[model samples]
Target: MYAPQDDTTLLVDALADEPLAPGARVLDVCTGTGALALEAARKGGRVTAVDVSWRAVCTARLNARLAGLPVRIVRGNLFAPVAGQSFDLILTNPPYVPAPGAHRMPRGAARAWDAGQDGRLVLDRICREAPALLRPGGVLLMVHSALSGADPTLRLLRAAGLTASVTERRWVAFGPVLREREGWLRERGLLSADDEKEELVVIRAERPV
Candidate 1:
């Protein structure tokens, strides 16, 4: 059940409101359905959407064509597809699931959901790499779980040498929680079996000009 979530629209609206400079270069990492990238393109940014899944990349390309926008859809893990290139803005909605062990992700879901044990695998990696890929004065916006929340994410960004902040937030209930080693999680008080829903947090960080 890795459908396009409402966070896509939320991120788009935020970026649009910022009024990105015309012709700015933008990157949308993990661009599942390409909603954010397409929206950025519509707002006058040269958008490039990258996904590790070939299928997702294809879907994004088709969606861009259908919407009559020129979005470059690339297939590679994180920044792999955009090596040697930097952007004025970068956006991502990465998989933030905290799978402690042998967790079974749904077919095709890994491309959209399935972070490492603490749900920070992709997020951490992105933060670590974003600064190098961002131009001076570039911005990065990401949507993740408030379960993991903004604190850890912002810490990682700062550690990566980027100035960061939480730009927006919204409450969303995505049904049951899925994690490997329930007893272990409970023992550590990280999660409980009875927890039915969780929160999502959207954060925006920047590379200094």
Candidate 2:
């Protein structure tokens, strides 16, 4: 099971002050341990959490049960499990770590963090499909590293007909996985040799009313 990391914490912090109507429908994509989903529910929103990893799904369900919060846990990629449903808010902390190999998914725990060569394997899909999952005036709050190109995220959302912008950004030191891959990142011009910190940004996109 994936633990709550800096990216997850950053996403939750961004959701802290977000306004939610009572019983608002909130969808959390790639929910690892249901942390964000639980936070949303605590704010009085009805939450649904989805993840491609069955382990993650199970972990999230258990966490929700232990917390006594009502979060619908589903096992599926992106928005598939919730097709035909629209939400008042959407949240995601997807795999944005650039993998060195072919765009194929990394196996095991790596799957939770490794994206494609450019680290957008799953993030791109979310950026394009999120608007459809949101109701009018609904919002999407997604967190990812700058290594994945924050501007690209914003551009994709805007091109898909949503108003998007970076609402929060925090610089954090590289985690174990990132620290191990630091050399390769620098080789690819993604990170500077002297830079030990990476910027994690919370992107907020809203569907027009």
RMSD of each: 3.0, 0.8
**Which segments of model 1 are wrong by more than 4 Å?**
100-107, 176-188, 191-196
lDDT of 2 by residue, 31-59 (tens): 99999999999999999999988999999
Model 2 bad stretches (over 4 Å) = none
Taking the tens digit of each residue's C-alpha lDDT, what string does model 1 give over 1-209? 35576667667767876658999999999998888999899889999999888888888898899999999999998999899999999999888766655265434655366676677778888888888999998989898876655798899898878898887877665534443444555675666567655556678888888
RMSD of model 2, in Å? 0.8
Q: Candidate 2, clashing residue pairs? A: none
Scanning candidate 2 in windows of ten residues, the lowest lDDT window is 99-108
* Predicted structure 2: clash tally: 0
Winning candidate number (TM-score): 2
